[model samples]
Target: MESAARNISFKEKANKALGIVPEDAIISKSYLFVSFIALLVGGVLGLLQGLNRAGLLELPLWFNYYQVLTAHGILLILVFTAFFTIGYFYAVLSHTLDGLLPKVRKMAWIGFGLKIFGFVLAVIPIIMNEASVMFTFYPPLAAHPVFYIGLVFIVVGVWMCAFGSFIQVANWRKRNKGEHVPILSYFATGVFVLLFFGSVPVAIEVFMIIPWALGWVETINVMLSRTLFWAFGHTLVNIWYLTAISAWYVVVPKVIGGRRFSDTLTRLVIIMLVVLNIPGGFHHQIVDPGITESVKFLHVFMSLAIGFPSLMTAYAMFSVFEKTAKKKGGKGVFAWFKKLPWGDVRFLAPMIAMIAFIPGGAGGIAQSTNQLNQVAHNTMWVVGHFHLTLGTTAVLTFFGISYWLVPFISKRVLTPAINKLGVIQTIFWTVGMIFMAGAMHWVGLLGSPRRTSYTTYSDHATALGWDPYLFFLAIGGTLLMIGIIIQVYAVIHLMFFAPKGETEFPIAEVEENATKTPYWTERWGVIIVIMLLVIAMGYVIPLVEMIVNAPPGSPPYSPW
Candidate 1:
């Protein structure tokens, strides 16, 4: 078997292999640049937020703790992750759609403009402490009207990006009759569809809240607000998870020298995710008043349904991994793991992230289980667990994608040193998260609350005991900052200094292409209809009761 890589420069391989042209690369680079900037800012806020919780780093008179917390959550989870997903998937779908139409490209740019403008509008108020409602915006504690309006623009931006893909896919399907959607595009379409579905409730919430924040409405229903927020919130995280799943099916296999696990099964899981994703948000409000136990139980059951798709993918990942290793001349069951491409940042980042999900999934189970939610509610345990899922699983996978993605977009090559830097960054990140997650989980069991400065209670004996764990948190947080800073430097280096060159994308080998793919795979209209029907069955009864027999809205609470 002669090497396919032989006699091929990276530039030649990329040019020959990828469907992208210079224009496509340029558009993606714009999104990547802003995403990195947001990550750097959010990364700093995260470090400070952690240290503040540990009773270190007193803020300047200009800054308030709650505002920083709000900014941290909003920027990283919403801006950074969302923009990256939009950008990454655009690139993925563009190839399959035979290059995005010029109008679609224009719409995406317009969307990006709104996102940046919206971020500017919102973040200024946050910096000045005028909008410190926290990311959940649990109302009665209202933000400046600008905050809601800014967020609305962000949502609109997301919609524009999403619909752009929809138009491209619909157009492609129209021109090429009876064609099976390519595998990556299939998953990307699923992400966009669910995102559109998730945004509706959020849009309505923002509409109601903005007027309330401006004093048009005398009161805001805190419970109702929280309920609506989570409706789309869980789906947002699921969208992030689905984007990673796309990598798992397509990119991961290629980077690790394996073919995709199973095309039909992968398509089925993507469909299952879309149909089952929404409506589980009710479980987040298990302890809130007015929602009945029966309804909560129903939500818990539906929330648990999400695990089915995840478990199915888990089976496929393990199978593909083991089979790939066996083909590489490895023997025995566990021994096959050694054949994976550990040194490649593309593989390492997501691998660590997937490993982190095991613990994150456990945390989710703890938080979602109606009974277990009591033990872990509002504790650092939940906070620690949430970090594992998004911070590690999603963010780390994004990091892996960034390694090659930025260079490919910028027409630059990653030097050997930068590649080595990514590996080291992953190590620092994994170790640091272990320390933080371990400390938080331990202290949470001791009844330490999340989102508080425990230093304020240092005079008490129980509070004094938290110092060691707090110390661990500070150490872990500092290391995490180092990891983020290294990546920030890596991104900047590639953007500005790395030598000009083209880079190749790792498009995974397909296992087999049966002459005919399942036609149901392309029947997205039917699937979405079924999803709406299932979701209505779960939500209508609970939500109708809350609206029809409404509680008096809660009076506003302004702490500052």
Candidate 2:
């Protein structure tokens, strides 16, 4: 078998120097630009929210902060993360295959352009205060028809990227004949499949509810809409994290100079992710009024089931790290920890992310418990939990992957000084989130709400306790924003100003003794279908009940 790296030659260097960027580089740059812009927009919104909560910002009582919050959450969580995940998958494929897909490449660029244009159109009426409907697009509270129409275009654009990826993987398999798909590629393909089906609800909601809200349809059921929305929303975060995990699987082994502890186990873990991701969406509905107690309990149990794969991952990766560290002349259980390259940003960022996962997993377990769910639902505690998991753990993994890939993609060496700054930035982000989450959790125990724009003093003691917690959260938010800015600066510098170089890192190789498996089992289509069935079993019953007994004038559940 020929190595893919053999295809690249010195001649390609001249092409790159002539300002003709490589396909992977272009994709990476595009996603980076989008993510940077998203960070700015989301940050401004966050700052405003914090200020409003603290009574530092005053506006008309009629002004809807809910709309602003919804936009910020959707842009950061849905749009930006999706763009990054797609771009990262493309980068990995280009690197591993040592080639580009021309049709896919063109499609991706066009999709990105259209999505950006759609976002601009959607935001216009929002900024003008003419569209104050919250992000969920629940019926009866209408925005401009353009907002919903534009959202549909954005979703269509994302689908185009997903389809392009599916085609590229299919082509790769056909061309390679008997070669086994690399485990990382296999995992990425699985995630794309999940993204494909998981987004259907949001697409439908945008098409149906937006028009309905705009009076195109006579009436829509609000409850049914939220149910469907969560069906999609629940799995969306999992999809994003799955991509992050794929990056971690590829990069962690390289950073630690260790083969995966068990190749079979790693594959099993991925299987579990596909199986467990969507069923757990029910866990999100625990606090809803109409849902039955039995169904919520079933989801709570399934949520616990999702933890199995996480534990498996932790065991496999840590064992590999332990073995590698000992082989390199370190000794003892904890001593190997000391030998790790703490100064290397690539190593540190992921290490911190993994550490944050300890808290994330613990919080998840808390939320999954029926009794605990009652205590935490709709409280600042929920806010703290997600930020720890998604913001600290998942976002940091993205940053680490970008650090490793930027130089390879850009054909330039990022400044070591800037890279060091990035490491510090990640530290601040992790620490700040920890403090903020802790404070929020404490306050939530006293019944502080999650979605409120401000906290009012109904009693002196409650007000005093809430005020201090809000103050701490404000400080944490400021620190996180600063860290985010530094990261943006580092990414921009790597793209436009980093010194060009000819050095090539070898295509990462899996050790010969690494795990091997049958081709049929690895096919992503089979895995994804099984996953969908599991999700359906959990969701189908509730959906039926929602349809049969939905209250009049209430929105139908729309899980996107």
lDDT for model 1, please.
Answer: 0.83
Task: Report the number of backbone clashes for model 2.
Answer: 22
TM agreement with the true structure for every prediction:
0.95, 0.91
Best by lDDT: 1
Taking the tens digit of each residue's C-alpha lDDT, what string does model 1 give over 386-492? 77898898889888888877887677888889999999999999999998887888788777888775464738888878878977887888899999999989988
State in Å the error of residue 280, model 2.
1.7
TM-score of 1: 0.95
lDDT value, residue 531 of candidate 2 = 80
lDDT of each: 0.83, 0.73
Q: Which residue runs of candidate 1 sit more than 4 Å off their true CA positions?
A: 1-19, 513-516
Question: Candidate 2 vs. truth: CA RMSD?
Answer: 3.6
